[model samples]
Target: MSSPALLPLCLLLLGLAAPVLAEEAPTPAPETPAAPAAVAPALERSQEQQQALMRQLPAEQQKTLQAGDESFLALLMPAARAKAAGTVVLVPGDGESADWPNVVAPVRQQLPTFGWQTISLSLPDPYDPVVAIEQDTAPADTDAQANSEQAAPPVTGGSGTAPAAPTQAEAGSGEPAQAAVAPVDPEAAANAQATRVLARIAAGIDLALQQGASPIVLVGHGTGAYWAARYLAEKEPAEVKQLVLIDAREPQGMPPRLDATMGKTDLQIADLVHAPGAAAQRRKERAAQKANKGYRQIDLPVIPGDRAAEQEQTVRRLRAWLDRLPPAASGSPAAS
Candidate 1:
């Protein structure tokens, strides 16, 4: 039944299909062994704006701005040694950059009395997260178990333990405490703000090391608080002991990322917002706190008076919370 022409035909069919098979197989990209060289960017130096900013400030304030990127970069380093008994980094709310110099003095004034050194840095690029995630990890060779052990406070008094706040309520059956869980858009401002806050956290760690403080804390307001939450959820390591959120704003639609990201054992989160809606949020947070374990959420009522009265009440509550925090922990929230 075999025919020479039939065999030849079969061979022809095979040859015809081979090209199609080869075409379907993807070709791998060429691998380069070396890193590409970095290109120097074109400068858009704003001489007029730069001159104006420099001229308007006092000598010290001007000096801080002119510290230059290169020099400032030199200020940051490995902060593994900057363990408990660390420094605090204070951040303001969004569109609140102008208050930095003014706020810094008061925070600095208050912290040293409680044995915390403070670092004040201006994080202008709060939207780019490519470099700033330094606040959470231990030294590259850090002993994680050791770092944690270092932060645990010694039992020194009669009760020998602080009162723990109850956890927040569970999902569906309960109210949303922090933020409603949702998908995060990679390009959203909240994400970018988180990136910037991460950088500030790193900067704060560097400041702590330079000031000879080891453990670190982050005191954030409004958007800064959102960033703090992000840092804790995404990057906070055992070294970041606490977070302090002052007048923290709306959840800003960043939840799912925070849901699995925040670890209660590593960082303590405290809230101090005074809006009318805070009452509802406070209840949900209290329930969440009770359910979560090892966390507390404090909601101080806004003062019913003029600016002076408001500031006075806020300061008093802040002082009380500060008293609750263990001395020299990272800038994560812990009342007392």
Candidate 2:
């Protein structure tokens, strides 16, 4: 119906519109895979717990110490009387806090009444879990069972032609091949932990010295004893003249064992052990006594379910031991 020139123009406009429409409708970009979320370190959790505990403590008694990038909690119980015997640096064992209800809290609270200042520290949790979780069946075992069933030939009602037996290659390779496991170096981990713990101990010693405490004593409970003994053996600070261990035990992955750690140190040590049938612990104490001239061992009766009695007896024995140490130089208080 239109003129010949108009038809050419219309064709040109339609061709232009077709190209524009094609350009507007482009393909969508591919989605990127999300990165795995970073996990919080185990130490962070312990620090969080420590912070919560610090909130519950009395402001006057609470103390915060900075060791490297981390801050640790310490509780200071000043002497009830004017003249303090000396400051006893208390390091709690694994799973214990600065004011743990067990021996740690009791000792820290009672020692001050006897004219001794107590500084209790909150130590880190064990690197490994104390009890491993059990699973019903391992993935590898399940896969192995499935592969064996698949490899077995099926039973037939009537055997016209028996199924061909599986080839040796197929049978041997049926189970998924296991990947090689990486080796772990326990000593390296222990050494790293020891380094951190030493820094904290040094900080505590500095605090004691600042308060004019003389003849500082390092007291460690359970695994903490190992740390105190190891620190004394390695650093041998002149200010810290004595070490006391209560219900002592070695930490996991630490080398040289508890007795060996105590034996190597020349510092005067009072090794106290409770509970029955502790043949191994007693033997180790004996070895340390034989090796070190200043080593003393005390066996206390374990009164289960009677925490007060146990703490009382322990304090009594410890007080007696402290009394026996050669009197400190004139004007210098002795360590308890």
Candidate 3:
């Protein structure tokens, strides 16, 4: 071959050989992603706590009741005497168990002796359920990249001032994608709590009726009073004839006011106001006055340093009030 032609052929051969050499070099394998760690399911705070509590209580007192989608615990003490006086469903306040020591425990234990069948319910915690979730921490690689960028000398322009690296908005646009969770709605959470509480209360009442007990009276303590009153005013169950509220306070941040709720029903009502200065206003409220001729608001003196005595005194007053009512009008579960 001539020299110029031979040179051209050699260049062509090298070009083909270069691609063959590059293809022979080993390529790195892709990395497999790490598996996600297991996460526990979210649970309602009150239900979880109460389930643990129910295990410690006596089996005899424990009653598993179902209401709507929820199953909850109730403590029942049948009438101590042969002749049943009546049934009283006790609804405890927020942060209290069915066997709460203060008013609920004492009343449920002692009331049966006075010929009353008592059942105390566990109320849900008035808050949104906590979700068990894992947050994505900033990737270690991201931090390393950020640090490397910060440490590097900026690229310069002809003017000598370094060209702008990148605006914050521009840099953020390339950030790795993350999980997006919507914020919980407060109104929806509150409504769910109210519905759950009301269902539990109704279940307790149904249990009493099933046992063939009559003259079912709903007694609510603390915020529970609001739930009980609201149930009565709304359901107007023919079986329940009276309501007793002890140290009653409406559930915070929600409601038809307790007074307005009371006004909706004509059932016999008693407001056992424990807070000083509350009795007078509760007495004058048009709701209470218009409720039934039987509505009465009585101020209770707090027995400081003696919880037992205070509970005893409250029970005594309740017993006396029951004695005043005419015999439960002929709606015994046995007769029905």
* lDDT scores in order: 0.51, 0.74, 0.77
Runs in model 1 lying further than 4 Å from the true structure: 1-86, 98-105, 113-115, 125-193, 250-266, 276-291, 327-336
Tell me how candidate 1 scores on lDDT. Answer: 0.51
Q: Give the TM-score of candidate 2.
A: 0.67
Model 3 ranges with Cα > 4 A deviation: 1-37, 42-45, 128-176, 278-280, 287-291, 329-336
Clashes of each: 40, 0, 0
Write candidate 1's Cα lDDT for 163-233 as tens digits.
33323222232422343234334446555555555666565555554555545666776666666666666
Q: Candidate order by lDDT, highest to lowest?
A: 3, 2, 1
Q: Which 10 consecutive residues of model 1 have the lowest summed lDDT?
A: 70-79
Q: How many Å off is the CA of 254 in candidate 1?
A: 5.5
lDDT of 3 by residue, 1-336 (tens): 789889989999999999999999899998997888899887666677677767787788888999897788888899988978888999998888887787888888888998999999988777533331111222335554554555435777787878556545347666433334445555666678778888999999899988776778899988888899999888888788789988888776675688778878887777787674553376447554584687877777689998878888888888888767666442454435
Query: Between which residue pairs do clashes occur in model 2?
Result: none
Indicate which candidate wins on lDDT.
Answer: 3
Q: Comparing 2 and 3 by lDDT, which wins?
A: 3
